[model samples]
Target: MKTIQVPTREQVNEEAQALFDQLQKRLGKVPNLYATIGYSAHALQAFLQFETSLNQGAFTGKEREAVALVVSQVNGCNYCLAAQTMAAVKRGLTQEETLLIRSGRASDQKMNTIVQLAKSIAENKGKSAQNLLAQFFEAGYSEAALIELTGLVTVRIFTNYVYALTAIPVDFPAAQPLPYALQEQPQS
Candidate 1:
C-alpha cells in the first residue's frame, strides 16, 4: 500500500505556511487533513475559500454542522464524522443530538428536514427526492436557503470524498460507532 504522508508545517509551500499559521492561531493546531491538503497549496487555498464562502451562506452554523454530520455519516467518512461531530458540539448540539443528526434524524423539526435533505443529496449524489425538497421548503426554507443548503452539502461531500480516498489519520477524537440499525447495509 502506498502511504501518503501528511506534510508538516515546514514542508508546505509559502502559501500553505501562511494558512498553517492562521489555522494554528485560530484552531490551536493545524488538523492533519488540512495539512494533507497543504501538499497542494492551490487546492488548500481553494478548499479554504470554498469553506469560507459556505460559512457566509444562509444556513446557521448549527444547521450547516447538522448537514455535515449527516453527509459524513452517509458517506462513511470517519475523518469528517469526527470533525463534524466536534463542530456540532461546539455549535450547541448535545452529543445525543449530534448522533441523531448523523443517523439522518433530528429532534428539531426544521433540523430534521435539513438532515433528511442532506442525507438524500449525499446518498443520491445530489439528486434529492422531490418530496424531500417539498418538505424542505414547507419547513420554511426559502429557495435561496435551499440553494445554500445544497452548497453546504456539496462542500461536505468534497471533504468526505477526499478523506475517503486518502484514509487520512483522523486528528480529532474518533466518533462513536453508529448504532447497528443506522449503519448502511449492502443493497440486495
Candidate 2:
C-alpha cells in the first residue's frame, strides 16, 4: 500500500500551517486528506475554513454529516466513504442509518429528503431537477436549506475530485466502501 504524502509541518506554507495547527488542535492530527490538500495550502485553508463554518452552521451536525456521506456515496469517493463513516459514527449516527446512507440506501423518513436532495445535487452538480427541488421543499426545507445543501456538495466535489486525481492515501481506518463505488484503488 502506498503511503499518503504528507508535507512535513515545516514544508507547509504559512496558510497551511495555521490550518494544520487548528486541525491538529481540533482533530488531534492532520488527516491524510488535509495533508494532501497541503500541496496547495491557501486553497486547503480556504476549504477547511469553509468546511468548519458549514459543518458548524445551519444544518444539524448529523445532517451535515449525512449530506457529506450521501454526496460521497453519489460521487463514489471511497476514501470519503471511510472517513465520513467514521465521522458519522462519532456524531452518533445509528449504525444502521450510517450503513444505509453510505450505500445510497437511506430510507428513513427524516433523512429521505436530505439524502435524496444531496444525491440529486451531486448527480446534477447543483442544478437539481425541478421535481427534486420540490421534494426538498415538501420535506420542510426552505430554499436556504437547499442552498446550504448545494454549498456542502460544492465543498465535497472539490475534495473528492482532488482525492481522485491525486489518489490520496487514507491515513484513517479502512471504512466500508460505498456499496457500488468503482474499485477504490488509491495510489501515491
Candidate 3:
C-alpha cells in the first residue's frame, strides 16, 4: 500500500519552507499534520491564516478548544484528538472536562450547548442541527458566533479528512482513549 509521507522542511518549496520556519519559531516545531499540509504551499498558508483569523474571533480559547474536542471525537480524527486534547488543557479545560465534551456534553450549561451543537453539526452534516442551533442561540450565542462556530467545525472537518487521507503520524502526545462509558455515550 502506498503511504503519504509528511513533508520535511527541506522537501517543500520556498514558500512552504518559509512557513515552516515561522511555525518552527512559533511552535518549536512544525506539527506533522501541518508539515503534511506544507506539501501544498498554498494550503499551508491558507490554513495558517484561517486558523489565526478564527482564533481572533468570537469564542474564547477554551470554548474553541471545547468545540474542537467534540468535533475531533465525532470525526474520529486521532491527530486532532491528540492536538486538541493538549490545546484544551492549555485553554484550562480539565482532562475530565475534555472527556465530557468529547461525549457531547459538559458540566457547564453554556459549554454543553456548544459541544452538543458541534456534535450534531458534525454527525448530521448540518441537516439535523436545527434543534442544537436553537439551543445554541438560546444559550446566548450570537448569529455571528454561530458563523464562527461553523467555520471552526469546517476547518476541523478539513483537518480530520486530511488525517483520514494521509494517516500522518500524530506529532502531539497521543490522546487517551475515551473511557468506555464516554465511548458509548449516546449523543443528545
Please report how far candidate 2 places residue 165 from its true position, in Å. Answer: 1.1
Instruction: lDDT winner between 1 and 2, please give it.
Output: 1
lDDT tens digits, residue span 20-96, model 3: 99999999999999999899999989998998999999888988998889999999999999999999998889999
Candidate order by decreasing TM-score: 3, 1, 2
Q: Show model 3 residue runs off by greater than 4 Å.
A: 185-188
Prediction 2 TM-score vs. true? 0.86
- What local distance difference test score does each model get? 0.89, 0.77, 0.90
Highest lDDT among the candidates is held by which one? 3
Off by over 4 Å in 1: 181-188
lDDT of 2 by residue, 1-188 (tens): 66556687788888788878988999999887888788788888789878877876668878888888888877777778788878888998876787677554567666777777787778886667787778778878887777777888889888788778777777767766434443334687
Worst lDDT window (10 residues) for model 1? 177-186
RMSD of each: 1.9, 5.5, 1.7
lDDT of 2: 0.77
TM-score of each: 0.93, 0.86, 0.95
Clashing pairs in 2: none
lDDT for model 3: 0.90
**Against the correct fold, how does model 1 do in TM-score?**
0.93
